[model samples]
Target: MSKHLLREISENIVKGDSIRTKQLVEQALEEFTPEVVIKEGLIPGMETVSARFQSCEFCLVDVVVAADAMQKGVQILKEKCRKEKAFAPKGRVVIGTVEGDIHDLGKNIVAVTLEGAGYEVVDLGVDVSPTQFVKAIAKFQPDLVCISALLTVTMLRMEDVIEAIKEAGLREQVKIIVGGAPVTQSFADKIGADAYVEYGTNVVYKADELLKKKGRRVALIQLPSILKEKHQEIFRKLFDFTPTFLDQNNRVILQGEELPECCRECREWNYEHNAEKTVVYSCPGGLSIIEARIEGDSIKLGKIICGPFLVETPGKVCVCAPGAKKVSSLELEKIAIFTQMIAEQIQIESREKLLQVQLEDQREILIRALKFQEELKNALNEARYRSLQSQVNPHFLFNSLNSLARLAMLEEAEKTEKFAYALSRILRYILRNIKSTVRIAEEIEIIRDYLFIQQVRFTDRLSVHLRIDEHIYDGLMPCMVLQPLVENAVVHGLEPLEREGMLEVSGERKGELVFFEIKDNGVGMSSDKLREISQLKISRSGRGHTTGLGLFNVHQRLQHYFGSNSGLEIQSQQNKGTSVKVFFPYIPQ
Candidate 1:
């Protein structure tokens, strides 16, 4: 049993079978410790996959599938492992996509990489504002801050991020790194970022490096390599010393005192180049080294101490003023290559995840569809069975009232009384079973009586025309169709128009087909908006939420009774008129 269980775990991992991985993990629960499975089997497997991923021997898809396989087992093991093992958080990092950009792929990739590298990563998601980042920083006090963006428009958000950090008074303590398609070293430097990484993998590396380099004063290296001989002499004359000094790492460090005046032009240029750029000191409360690129030149000046005059801060620092050179095509190409590689790896990882998600979703949909079909079949069978067993559903009662009205009218006991009695009964029935289907003839009579009542309600402000064919008298239709259609034309359509409008209702039967048409010459819908009406699925309710379900409900009921091919057809032209035609196959007794 032990050997078989071990083989099961190994086989699932070697095959990169996520489903099997889940099965193995479940089976292992009876005997093996969750910690043993996680630490010995899953974690080691993931480590190998990550290595294969880095070596390019295994594409990101393979690695991700392997990761998912591991995650499946790890998830089951995690809760148990928490109880069984002492787990320590490997430093926290807060990450977000900057404001105005909604892209999350880059940020998600970085987060996954950071977690894989054993750091606890808190993802703040996308479109995060400066204040939000600052608040997060203050709350988390993370070892590092990571910001990402994809669009050029939102790239300016990095400056906002910098300002937010400064405002929180934790700017010095937190090391900041920026990356994305549009982010560059110049942008990072301008925004006062501690570092800028080109890719997600590099993000992990940068975070680690920044953590190691924390508390150590980094020398600002000047670009002494690009200064022309003549410019170097002029610089020497102005400063009475060499403008470049190589600190420990060949980074140019400049004298803190000599840099203030020379840096004024570049500060103005910073403002000129970037709207968000301001001449903020290198450090908020302490003198610190800075590298400033001379504007519109191919020279970069190395490090200089920037602070209050005569505040002597002792430190081994080098200032080298490099030539102010436009970033060459070669350098831009390198950055692009690295970003694209990272994006590709991320894309592969995302695809694997998407595929798994799609498979799961498809399984759920299939199950749901099968269940719905069964319910629909049972509903249809029940409906037919009920139809056979039932006698008359108030429709017969309505006709009996009409007959009673005729008899009363013959006796001459005031015609209005008989009409009112019939009206009250019809209204009561319609209110009772708003969802039930009635015979076509009965529905037509209801419409006729409704129109008669509305003529009295609106008092000559409205008019109605109704016609019916004898052949459809026995066909089934939902109650309240004609009344609501007419009501719609009057209340929403014709009432809004000042002109006297014509409302027409006609019905006919051609062979086995029953057709009902309602036309109104009032305010009509435009082509664009009218097209949207068909797609609208509204709920039928008397008062709650304005269900907008009147005509739509009638249409759905028609289709429900007479198959999908037979339903409502509506047409309208703006400010002219609207027409609705209902077609259904008449099934005779």
Candidate 2:
């Protein structure tokens, strides 16, 4: 009879019949335990919804409605579970969209999916700044943090959040997961996120994996044999320092070396204070180590050295290279990840021995670990890519310097000095405002400088005119915004022409929007070329030199910073002229 009721409950949930689901929950509670009803009915129903959603049998709206039905049923079951003392959450998660972005559709779906997976979720909603995430971490003390950003502009804030977590000394305590349309696994790795979920439903599995890795432990007696030959290699190559294990009495079990003086002091303090939670400390030699208490045992995990520099308290794991003067937070995070993997292997061995699991299951575990290792390798490669992107492009700098030298050699003292000043201003602005916005007026000034340099190079063959409203000068926009458009206009539209070329730069305010137009009378593109550029089908080399790259980057930045409606509109005709108009919501300082 209860099985029949459970089946009915699952059907109602799939159908998104909230009223019927609630009614069925109440009826089931009268006959069966809340644990049974939740385990057999609500969980299965949500799983079916997730499966259908993944399979494309159910749309986003359908899944959302189904989730609502499931939530209602869970709410009713919660009371019964509490009364019966059978309530248990799968995990705890704190989630939010990054600052400067208000899109919540993707975030909502992830939150609901996590909740359906039996996680106690703390939803921070949208436009969540780095400080807010830090505060939430301190308060909620969640096992995981999921950050969402739909726009590329806002996606950059994820790095800021990770930095804030490190500053607050809580980076090691929780796992971070990032997702959204613009977010990629590479970006996640670059931002030092623990995991990246390509699909919303995958969040559940990733979260589970992270939690398992965190709670994983290995007894000292079982460590060496469990890891076999890979054990020594991991400690020496990854951790730098030897691995040490301690028993309840503070006696060394797997002897490696005496604890560093600072680590010894921390251990003494922990013993004196009866510290139960994990503690992280840095030694006088500038090595970072973490000490965590093993659950249900007197044995404690000793301070595992991460790298040469000390990370602040509360970060879960630290990864860094040995003999380095300074270690980046991201590098430390990688060390922490590898440490968890090692610990996971230890835990797996323990499980195999205790549960006597099949040989196939052991092989499966090994395969999963290998897959994780591949992910780590990819993340490291992406980290290197991010490092490259952070530096100024040498080619551009070299070209600008050459142009300035040419002007100096021509005895054009005024032009040389002006070009040097403009180049300095541009580089200085980029360096100072890598993660910030600037006023439109400030951007316009940079654009004027940039155009001046181009005008001098082209001499009488090039001319530019600027007409901007003073009233809208204080409107805020991303840094280096206008300069790219101006550069694209001159390089792609004006420089190719042999005859006189005219460029017009203008701005105005209309209602709630601010518009800027860059018009050039040079070599206008044909209709087919325009269409190809619009569709982003033309490669960088195919679209003439810097034109395609600069234009595409600027268009993407505009749309990311403002909205989809706020981007470049290209109007051109072959051999006539090209006009690129950009607009965004008027946001006053």
Candidate 3:
């Protein structure tokens, strides 16, 4: 449970869930020491956010929010850090953004990353002048001085700050490292700074070098082995949301949802620098979505995208609103971090699965599977044998009927021959489809044989209609489903009626499902009787039956295979009519 909490803490931090981070840090504190929480959760998450920023997979906004979440968590663990000595403060460092450049996102990230690494970070806010740098040095006598700048013009201030520390005679007391978007290694050398750093996490190694310190101050975070493919499915399970995508060509990659994604051409937006853009697309349904693109260095390397979220909820919800979820702006920032992490994790896992397997393990797994092959085959055969034993024999009845049909045809009794042929066809259909699924078209043929036999028997009193749509003819359903209801309509409903009996079997394809109805006009059942049939407490025939498959048996099978959305529904009025409507998933083979 502690390990799970640690994972959640790391995830929440990556998600920029700051309010929840503070709570998680406190809960984790009860199970783990402050150092353990920071190392296992806070530092790893912040490092991931920073790396994404450097890779251009995350914009400044994502890093800033993730850093803010880390800061909130660190604030909770501050006092405890003063008590524990495992990850005691390594050194005191004064860090801030340079003068005339108001960007402190870089500085805050550096401070938080360093602090999470067990350094005592004295963040002197943003826009610190050269005098402030020297003043901070005089007061703290820090081991290192880190200055940041985000613009070309303000980066020169780093040199001025270094010069002031020299003039104040504090140069020998501390090492100065220069870093920012505009600061380069050559620029750092020209400015006489001790070291130039690019990534915030890399700064820890550089700081250790500048101070001649040793012994692994920071731990690198690696995704676990369980991380695998199904990147889209994993994200949906984790966040209760579906994510959309864009291909390498920068075109919207679609998955055929009811809601359409933006289908702009590749040339419309440049993919070269898309890694830096915060994409929030407005869908055709007027719902806003957040997206992050993680592309490989080569064209063959694919991208993991995160979107399918609304910026804000709609006043009048979209007809396709279920496809896109709503999230806060801060939660959206965390997605950029998470999208890149999972994308890289899956790619890494895919490569590692092949490389890390041993010959002995592979051979053992193959040998074990082969050893069980015969047992598996025997078990399947035994199960099928048991299933066959539970059902009544239909072959003997079919053979005897076939002989009677031949004799009737020889005697020139046309009605007798046709009735026996229809009965034989129904029995053959039952035998063939008993254990397998059947298309509507195939199932309808058996129903036709059943109605034919009944029509011949009742002649003037019976009337039947089949208004089936050809569109649903190819849709699949459980075998022996429609015929049972047709048998019930003919045997129980029509046979008991004094007036002309009427029956209808109609089915049609509606969207992803097919709707089927077996309605009858006869001596209709009462409301209480309808309830009893629906509740599975009574059989429609009470004892004598056509096929052994009852209404309840068909109902149970429908629910078992297709879920609760399917199964039997009985509606009737005393002496009026009864209708059994059924609906289930429709998949055409």
Candidate 4:
């Protein structure tokens, strides 16, 4: 009976009824501890809210209402606990966005997630100064201090906060974590932070890892197949809305309508560029379409297409076709939730083999792609192309994508620019020289670029440290040599492992030789596997392997360029980590 009542309390919170929620909490307290009431009742509702928020079901207004209801229940619990003197929070946290940055959306999410996770959170609102942080650490005596900044320029305030804490002699009392739109693990390490996470959901798990020895796994997901009718059924049950699925080319494969002629004005709007959706976006036609892009690894596969539905019944808000479905604004909120779920499901299904095959195919193509450029261009124009080809208006897409990019730039231009340039530099370097020798500095610089990209992708999961002597920067090595080994360390070594990843790249010169190493604390290879790798050979190397460039290709090229002694020496033990050593004669460029 108490369990039944507790479930009702959760439901009421979801409905955002603070009055009824408080009354239910009063009833619940008679039969339950405040902790039980919080964990089993309030947290579940807020967790649902969080899930819905992630999916787009709940907007900021919805979240505020639900949070208010939750806080009402929490207040009642706090009073009860005070009377009993028996409430214990998991830990205390001090959270804020750093000074000079006012963004707090993510910070708000983190605070809420931590509270639900049983941490007592003290929120220091946006544009928080370093001295303010230092004071809070001293006053709250928190177990963790979380600093967030949405802009690259303001994120520097995190380092200042850390310095202030150190100056206050409060550094030893709390672990510090930094997060934001543009913050990276390299930046975190550079700023003397304890951890860096891409999303707020990771805070509790990450905090637990820092405070305790416990660990959590963060995995990547991709859609393996097209959406089916069954998935549409889910939307129907939840929102009285079924969806259409379209391929990348906007070719409708399932239940979908042709985009309204008015939507042509939005032709330059690219849905595939970002992980966000439009809710009840009205086209030039009186009818409206609700839509969300289906993306994998930042590529748009298709859209979970819905609508041409009415925002209001015909002849009310506006006239609609007699057969068109009418949807309420509240339902649009629900659609956000539905869209997020389908998109995540698409992403979470493991498509490792498919992606690997695609990677190999692209590598094989690119090495020879330049030679067949004209033919390929002709083929692309005449043959029709793309993973899921459907026609789209380039202008609408460019404008939409360009606008989104501008918004992101407005928030964090420095980091965005850095990533774009880094990728450009790496791609340009890869294409220019496949069969040529290059300076060690060139290899190291590209590796840094590669790692920077990985750091952004993996966030808290990957941390790197590089130590190189100036002596080897100008030394010669085959082009694209070291990057593959480093890539191997990341993909084969660190990525598959369950724990946090640690990567180390070091190079130094000794006498007549230059020694370079790529090491990872990941799920290492077995002795037999190591021996097999040792014996592996490249049939013919033009550019690179299973990934982009194979380890054997690098080894074979190094030996060919220098001597037998100048190749790779790998040592590994399963569940431990792997280290690959590269040594060659000190040949200057």
Name the top lDDT candidate: 4
TM-score on alpha carbons, each prediction: 0.31, 0.39, 0.36, 0.31
Q: Write down the TM-score for model 3.
A: 0.36
lDDT against the true structure, per candidate, is 0.60, 0.69, 0.70, 0.71
User: What are the clash counts of all predictions, listed in order?
Assistant: 35, 5, 0, 15
**lDDT of predicted model 4:** 0.71
State the lDDT of candidate 2 residue by residue for 1-589, as single tens digits.
8699999999999999999999999999888766567667876787798799889999655776787787687677655544453347777899999875666656765776676567888989888988788778766779899999876555777898999777666776689999987789998998899999976657888999998776553344433334344554667675565555454355654554344444444532221111334344454334555454432222343323333445443443423323333455466556555555555555556556534533543454445445645665898899999868856574467467667866775786866766787776766666666457789998898888778878788889888899999999999987766777777778888888889999999999987778999899978999998877765455523233432336656655565687444666789987888998888778999
Ranked candidates, highest lDDT first: 4, 3, 2, 1
Better of 3 and 4 by TM-score: 3
Pairs of colliding residues, candidate 2: 172-315, 172-316, 318-336, 319-332, 319-335
Q: Write the per-residue lDDT of candidate 1 for residues 200-301, one digit (tens) a residue.
A: 556767887887665233112213332234433443453332333334344543332344445443432211111121122332222223222221111222
Give me the candidate number with maximum TM-score. 2
The CA lDDT at 202 in model 4 is 72
- Evaluate model 1: give its lDDT: 0.60
Model 4: lDDT of residue 523: 95
